[model samples]
Target: MDAVQGTLDELGTPLSEVTFVVFDLETTGGSAAEHAITEIGAVKVRAGEIIGEFATLVDPGGPIPPFISVLTGITDAMVIAAPRIEAVLPAFLEFIKGTTLVAHNAGFDTGFVKAACAAHGYPPPVNPVVDTVDLARRVLTRDETPNCKLGTLAKLFRSGVEPCHRALQDARATVDVLHGLIERAGSFQVHTLEELKSFVRAPTPEQQRKRHLAESVPHSPGVYLFEDERGEVLYIGKSTNLRNRVRSYFTAGETRPRIREMIGIAERVRHIVCTTGLEAEVRELRLIGQAKPRYNRRSRFPEKVVWLKLTDEPFPRLSIVRDLKDDGAAYLGPFTSGRAADDARIALHEALPLRQCTQRLTERTRRAACVLAEMGRCGAPCEGRESPADYAVHVENARRAMLSDVGPVFTALEARMERLSVEQRYEEASVDRDRLAAYVRAAARMQHLSSLTTIPQMVAASPAFDGRWEIHVIRYGRLTAAGVMPRGAHPTPFVEALVATAETVRPGPGPIHAASAEETECILRWLESPGVRLVEVDGDWALPSGGAARHKARIEHAYRGLERRRAAEGRPLR
Candidate 1:
C-alpha cells in the first residue's frame, strides 16, 4: 500500500515521483527572531521509501540558555566543537536541494530557518512544503478525533511509535503518521508544487475567523486558548502577539497531527492579553496546570523523583525518603533516579571515612570496622567509637555543600590553581586542583544547574559595524534613541557607553527619511563623542565606580532586591 501515490489526485503522477525531506530543529525558544537553532535533524524520503538521514548540532554563535539545554539535552559543550551555521547550512541546502520540506509543524521550523538564512544574507528556500497537519485536518472528522496531538494521533492509528522531543525522531514519526493517515483515508488528494499553489484558495472562512480573532487579539501580551467543537480545550499557548498566535493554528501546514485535529475541531477561540511576555508565560503555565488539557504533555506536579539519603544508621544505610526523618541523621537520596541517588551516596561515602557495613550502632559495642573504616575511609561508627552527634554534624555540613555553593567553590579552587601555575607552584597546587576538578565533574553529573537572569529588556541589537549606517536605540518597543556611526566605526568610550547601556536598540531611519548624507555624518560624529548619553543607564551597566568591592556589594543587593520585588508582586522583570 504505497499511500504516498494513492493519496494524491490523478493529475499528479504516482506519489513515488514525489520526494520529501523531513526536518526538525531544536531551538532556544518559540520565536524565530528572538531564539536560535542549536540542532537540526533530517530524513529524506523518495517514492515512499527512506533514502538517507542526517542530524547535526550547530554552533548558534551564542550561549544555549539553560532552559533550552534542559529541554533538549544539547549542551553548550556538545556544540562547542560543531561547525557554525554559515559553514554547515550550504551543505545542508545541497543535501535537500530538490526535495519538498516536510515537518510536523512546518511553518515554525521553516520560518525560523528562513529568518536565520536572511540574517546571514542567504537566498530563501524555493522548495515547496507539505504539512502533514493540514492533511489530517482536511480528512479527519473534528468531533471524532476531538484532539490531534502527534502522540494522540500515533496512538489513535495504533502506529506503535515511541515519542521523543528530539528533532530527527520526531520528523521520522511525523512521516510515519502521514503514511498511516494516507493508508487509512482511502480518498484524498496530493497536489504538486504548481497545482497546489494554483489551487491554494484565499484564506477559507475558517481561516478568516482565525485571522479576525488574531487581529482583534491585543498584541500587547497574553495567553490564548484554542477550543474544539465540544468546548474542551485542545491547546493552551501564550504569545506576545495574541492574534498572530491564534491565527498560526489556522495557517497550519507542518503542525503536529494532534494540533491539526485540534484546529479542525476548534469552533471557538479566546485570549487573555497581558502587560508583558513574562506574565503571559507564567499565566500560561498556571492555566495548563488548572485545565490539564488532554493534549498537553508537560508535568505540573511539584514533586520530582525522590533521592536516597545516607548516614542514618551506623553504616549510614542508603534509603529513599522524601525528607530527613530524624535528628542524628544526614540523609541524601531524594533524587530522580535510584541509580543516580546510589551513585551520589557512593561518592559521598568515599569522600568521608564511614562504616560501609549494614550494621547498627549501639553504645559500648565493639566490632571489627568494615573495609571502609579499616582503611581510614570511615569514622568507625560501626564500633560505637565515633559519636553519632559528631558524625551528624559532618553529614549536615557535607549535605549543605552539596546543595548550595560546591560548584562555584570548585571552580574558584581550579582558577586559583591555574593562577598559581604561572608562579611555579604546580607541585603544591596540583593535588587540590585535581580534587576540585573531580568535585566539579561530580556536581555536573548530579544535575546541571543554570541560573535564570532577568531577561534583559535589550540585548546586543546592532549589527557589527557594517559600514552602511548609524546604530539607534529603541525604547519600550519604539524608536526613541538614534545615533549615527561611520562604517567600520571603532569602539570609543561613548560607543562603549552606548553598548553597555540597558537601552533597547533599533535600526536607523532609511536614507529617504534622512536630512542629508553630511548631516547624517555629523549626527554620527556627535554620537561618537564621550559626552553623549542615550537613555539613563540603569543598574551596574551605568555604574562609574570601576567595580570596587562596595560597588560589587551594591550590585548584588540590587539584583536580590529586584528578584524579591518580582516574586512578591507577581510581576515579570522589566
Candidate 2:
C-alpha cells in the first residue's frame, strides 16, 4: 500500500507539490497609494514543509500615526534606522520569485508590494496569488467556521501560530489556514493547483492563471493587444474603459469560441491609453490595418477598395476603377466591395444618359453604337450621332451627380420604384430602390469626408467624464495629437501645445486624403456626435450646398414605406 501510494503521488499534478510564499505586510495605513510599508514578512513552504523565511523592517520615511503604532507593535523609534523599501524590495522579490503568493486578504498585502514596485521603478510581479480568506470561504462551511477572518480561521483550524497584529505572526497564521483549506479541498478531489484554483472558482481557471495580465491596464479609454508567447500580436481591440473591457474577456461571460481559444494562448495583454474613446477607436482601426493581426477581421484590405471615376475624355464615360488619382476627374468612392461600386454605377446609368462602352471615344474617331443607343439610354457618343459639345453636357451632369448632387438619382429612382410598385413589379422596384440607396449613401459619405479633408487644420474639444476637456488636433482629417485640459485652464496654450506636436499629414488624392476611410469615418462620427465643440478651423468645415444630404430623408421614407407594405402583405423583406 505504501509503494502504491508513493507511485500515485509521484504522478499527481502540481498543487500538492507546488512551492508557496505566504507573505504579510504591515503598513502605516490602509491605502497603499497613501500609506507606506513599515514591515515585510514571508514564509516559503513546499509540501507542508518550511523551505525558507524572510522578515524585514522597512523605513517608511514618514512618521507613523499613534493609532497605527497601537495596532501593530512597531513604532517610529523602532523603524527609524530600518532599511528603506527600495533597499529591501529586491531581496523580498528574489525570495518569492516563481512561487505562488498567499496571504490572509491578499489585496491589502499585494497592493503595497505593487505600489512599492511601481514607486521604486521595478516591474510588478505576475505571480499567481492565493488568498487564504477566499480559499477558506470556498472550502469551509459556515458550521465549520463562523467567519473567514485570519484570526477566526486560524483558531478554528488549530494553527500552531496565533496572529497578534504583527506582520510575521499574521503571515504564519495565514500559512496554517491555507494548509487547512487545502487539506479540506482534497476531499472534493481537487489535488492539482489548477483544480484547487478551480475549486475556489477564481473567475475561471485558465483566465485566472493569466488574469494578472490585466492588472496594469488603466481604467481609461485605450487600445489593447493580446499577444502570444513569441510576442506576436494575436488580436487588437479598443475600449472606452480599458481595464473593465480587458477584464471582461477572462470572465465566464466571454462565450466566443475564437476568443476563448485566444485567451488560452495569450501570455501578455498590452494597452495604449488614449485621450478619448474616439482616438482609441481610430487607433484600433489604424493598428489593425497596419498589423493585419490574425484575429482581427476588419481594416485588413484597403487596397481592394473600388471607386467610381468619371473618365476625362472627349466623350467621357463613367468607369468603375480601383485606383484614385489626382488627375482632375470626379471620383465618388472608397467603396469596400466591387459589387457595391457596381450598384452605384447602375443607379447613375438609370438617372443619366451617358454612353457605356468598353472602347474609348473621340469626337473625330467614330464607332458603331450598341443596343443602349437604340434604347435611347445612351447619347451614342461613340458613333458620332452625339456631338462632343452635347456629350459634354451628359459628362458634366454625371460629374455633378457623383460629387455634388445625388438629388436627380433620388428623384428618378423614386419615380421608377412608384411606377413599378403600381404595376405589381415588386422585385424590380426593390432592386431600383437598393441601387438608388447605395448611390445616396456613398455620396453622403464622400461629401462628409470631403468637408474635413479640404480643411488645412482643425481643433476640437469635448467634455471629459472628470470635469475636464479632451482636446484633439486634426490636420487634413487625420487625428494628430490628443491631450486633456484641466478645468478652468486657458485653452490657447493647451491648443497651441497640441498643435505644435501634432502629426504632420500630407494630403493625397482621395476623398479621405490623409488617412484610411475607416479612420476618417471614425473621426467624422466623433465630430458629429453630441458635446463636441469646434475650437478652430483654418478653412470651411461645412458640407457642400448641393451634396446628397437631401436624398437621405427620401431613402429613409422609402425604407419605412417598404417595411410597412411588407408587414401588411406578410412578405419577407429583401
Candidate 3:
C-alpha cells in the first residue's frame, strides 16, 4: 500500500515562486469613497530581489488640504503639472500586472485603486491581494509592536528605509515589514502563498512548545483525538494528513476560541490511521458520536434525532418518532428538530385526508368525530363514518404522496394559497405558502433518501489526489465499509476486502429508513461531488421527474422573494 500524502498537497504556488508588488498611497482623506489620491508608490519584488519600481504624484483635480500637504509634503504645486488619476492609474495597473498586490492596511490602498479604476470606466484588476496589517496580526503579538501601523512596523522590523509620510518611502518600509513577517511565518511551516493568505490566528507560546506532540503522527489520512490531562477526549477531527493537521492546531492557524481552550487543556494527541479519506470521515463521525467530546458541536446527539413516520394502520396517520424500527411504515426524516418534524407533519396533513386521531379504529369501533373530521379535514375513520375500504384508498394516496407522487399535494396547497390570496387574507396566504414549501422541502429530502435506499448494494469511487481511487461500499445507503484502490489495481480484490470487512448496520424501523440524517447527508454530498464514479449498483437509484423534487426550486425562489418583500416593508416574517 502506498502511504497517504498530507492534505496540504504541494498544489499551491510556493512563496518563493510568487512575485509581490508592495504599494502605498497618500490620500487627501481617510475614506476611499470620498478621498482623492495625492501620491502613488509601488515596488515589484521576486524572491527577495527588487525588479521594478513605480512612483508618481497625481493631480487630484481639487485643492490638496493644507493638513494633508503638511503631512505628505505633496503640495498642489508639486502635483500641478502631474498627470491626473485617469492617466496614472492605467500605468500603475500595468506595473503590478500578474503579481500579488501588497500594502499596509491593504483595504485602504486597494480601495482607492479600485475606486479610481471604476471611476475611469476600467475593469478592476483581479489579481490576488495581500494585507501586511492582517499578516502581522497573525504572526506578531502586541509586545512586538504597540500597533499594526506602517511606522510602528518599520521601527519594529528596523527597516533601512524609514517612512516620512511619503508614498515611495512608505512603500519601501512596507516591503521590509512583509519580508520580516514572511520569514517569521517560516517557523510555523507556512511556505505557500495560500498559507500566508489564510494565516490569521497567532499561537501562544504554550501552544508552540507542544509542537513536538504532532511530530510522531503519520503523514496519512486519519482522525486525531485531542485529550485532556485526565485522558478524556476534548475533541476529535479528521484530515488527509494526520501530522500536518495536528500540527496546525498547535500553530496560529487554529482560530476558534473553543478550540484554543481545548488545545490548552489537551495533553496528548492520538490518531487512528485510515486507508482512505472516506474511511477517515466516517470514523470521525462515529467517534464524535461515541465520545461526545466537549469541542464537537455537531453529530454528538444522534439519539435526539427524530423522524416523521406514517403509521402502519388501517387509517395511516403521520407522527413524529425518535427511533426507527423494522415496521412496515413509511418515514420521512431523522429531522434535526421536533419543530421541523412537526412542520413536515402539518404539511402532510394539509394535503392528505388521513386521520389525526390516535385511537385505533376497527369495523365495529365507535367514537365521536373530532373537529378535523367535522371541518372535512379528515376521513373520520375513528367515528366509523368512513369504511375501511375508503380509508384504505386515502392511506394509499398518502403513501403515494410520501414515497412516489406529490403532485396532488402541491396542487391542493397551491389552490388553497390562491383562494386565500383572492380573499385578501395575505397572512393566511403566507402561512399556506410556508406549509407548501415545507412539504416540498421534505418531499425532496425523502426522494433523495429514497433513491439511495432503493439500492441494496453500491460501489462508488472518486479519484484521490494521490493517484488512487477512494472506494466506498454502501449497503442500504449507509456506508458499510470503505477502502482505497491503487490507480491501476484490479477492483476484484478491493471489492472482496470491502465486502468481507463491511459492517452490518440494521435498517431503520421503517422500510424507507436508511441511517441517521447526518450520515446520509454526508454520503449524498460526497456522491454529488465532482469526479465521483459509480463502479457498481445493485438496484435502482434515481430521482423522480414529476415528483415534488421538480417544484422545490421554484417554491424556494418564491419564498425568498416573499421574505425580501416582507423585510422591505418591515413586516415580521413567520
Candidate 4:
C-alpha cells in the first residue's frame, strides 16, 4: 500500500504537502514581554498526517501568579531548577520553522510569542497562524454539546487523550481537535503556502484590479458589486452563491444582449459575505435601501397598489377595483395588479348570484319567475314576484362572504357538509371547502396584531469625559437600562441644553434619548473595565476617561440624564 500520509507516525506529514505545527505554551502570565514562558509543547503535521513532536518546560524569570499556577498546575518551584526561557527559545522557534502555527485561539498564543520575541530584540515569527476557534465555528455544528474545548473534542472523538494543563498535553489535544474538524469538513482539503493564503483572505483591492480573476472566488451567500474603471458602481446583485453568479457573467453561454454589453464595461467585482441565508437577505435589502441600485428591477421601483371597491351607486354596484386610500369605507386588495383585484370580484359574483338580471330572480315584465325562481334559488325579482326587501337581503348575504369575517363562520358551517355528503351532498362540501381556503387567505391580511402594551424608553448619549458617553435606558422613571459608551466630545452647548432637558425630564412618559457619539465611546471604555457589573435594567459603568475633565463632565451628564429619565418613565428613581 502507498505510505498512508494521514497516519504518518513520526514525520507528522499528512497526505497533502501542507505543514502545521500544533503548539501550546504555559506562561507565568499572559503578557509574554513582561512575563515568561514556563513550558512549550508541539506536534508537527503535514497533509493529514503527524510527523514529529516536542515538549519541555523553562524557568520563568518571575514568580507565577497564584491563579495561573493553580489552573495550569505549574509552580514557581517546579521552574526554579529549569533552564531560563532564553535557553529554550531558539529550539522552540526551530521546531516550528517553516510550519504554519496552529492553536485553539491562535491570536492568544501568537500575540504572546510575538511579545516574547520582541523582548529579546528578535523579529516576530512571520508564519501565518490559524485560529481553530474560528474554523470550528464556521465548519462544525454551532450548538455542539459539552462545549468546544480540547477536552470536549477529545471525548467526542474517543481519542483517549489525557486531561492536563501541561503544554505538551494541550498541544496534542489541539492536533486531535484539528483532525476531527477536518474529517467532518468533507472534500475541503487543506492547502499549503500560496493556496492557503488565498483561501484565508478576500481578494485585496490591488489583486482585484487584475483580469481573469472571477474564477478564484468561493461560492457563498453574499452581496456582489460590479464596478467600472473609475471605481463607480455599475450594478449590484445579491446571491446565495456570489462566486457562481459573478462567474456566470464571464462564462460563454446564452446571455441577455444587455448583460453581454454590460460585462464589457465591468472592471472589478467586490462582495460582502454574510454568515446565514436570512442574514444575507436582510443585508441585501439594507444595501438596496442605501445605494438604490439602478439596474436591480424588483426593489428599485415603488408602485401604487389597487383594491376591490364597492361603490355607493343607485344600485350599490360592486364595481371593478380602485386605488387604496385612507377613506372610511373598507377596500379589499392592494393586490399586485388591478386586473387581479377585478378577477376576485368576478369569482365572488359567479359563486353567489345577487343580481336581479339572473334568471333565478323575478323580472318586472313577467308575472312568474324563471327556472331558478321555481327552484327557489332566487328571490323572484325578475318576475316582480319578490319584495325588494327580500332581494336586498340576498345582496347583503353575498357582501358578507366577500367583506365580513362571517365568511369563515359560514365556511365552518359548510365543512360539516361531509355529513350531508353521506346523504349525497358532495357538491355542498366541495364548494364550501374551496371558499374556506379563499377566506383563510383574506384573514391573513390582519398581520399587524399587537397591543403595544409596554413602551420602552431608549436613550443613547455621551458624557464629555474623555470623549465618551453612555447610552442609558429609563423605564417608568428609573435607570432600567444602559449601553456602550458613545464616541466623540459632548459639545458644551448640547451638554448645557441636555442638562436643562434632564432637569425638566420629569419621571416617566416620554421619548427615550439615544446616546451621542461621545457617550458611546465612554460606554465602550466602561465595558472594558475589570470587574464591571452587567445587570438587568442597567449596564451603567464609569469609563476611565484617560484623565480628561471634559470626559468627566460627559459621564456626569449621562448619569444625571439617566437618573431623570428613569424617574419620569416610572421605572425606578435611581
Per-candidate TM vs. native? Answer: 0.42, 0.61, 0.60, 0.39
- The regions of model 4 sitting more than 4 angstroms off are 1-15, 47-49, 145-147, 189-574
Compared with the true structure, the alpha-carbon lDDT of candidate 3 equals 0.78
Steric clash pairs (candidate 3) = 324-509, 325-509, 326-509
Q: Which sequence of candidate numbers ranks them by lDDT, best first?
A: 2, 3, 1, 4
Off by over 4 Å in 2: 1-210, 553-574
- Could you give the candidate ranking by TM-score, starting with the highest? 2, 3, 1, 4
RMSD values for the candidates in order, in angstroms, are: 16.8, 25.3, 16.5, 24.1
Task: Pick the lDDT winner.
Answer: 2
Please report how far candidate 1 places residue 130 from its true position, in Å: 7.3
What tens digits encode model 2's per-residue C-alpha lDDT throughout 211-257?
88899999999999999999989899999999999998888665343
By summed lDDT, the worst window of 10 consecutive residues in model 1 runs over: 447-456
* Alpha carbon lDDT at 62, candidate 3: 90
* Model 2 lDDT-worst window of ten: 565-574
Query: How many collisions per candidate?
Result: 28, 1, 3, 72
After best superposition, candidate 4 residue 474: deviation in angstroms? 8.5
Against the reference, the lDDT scores of all candidates come to: 0.54, 0.81, 0.78, 0.51
Residues 122-179 of candidate 1 have per-residue lDDT tens digits of 8989888865555555556545565445665666666655546577777777778767
- Find the number of clashing residue pairs for candidate 3: 3
Native RMSD of candidate 1 (Å): 16.8
Judging by TM-score, tell me the better candidate of 2 and 4.
2
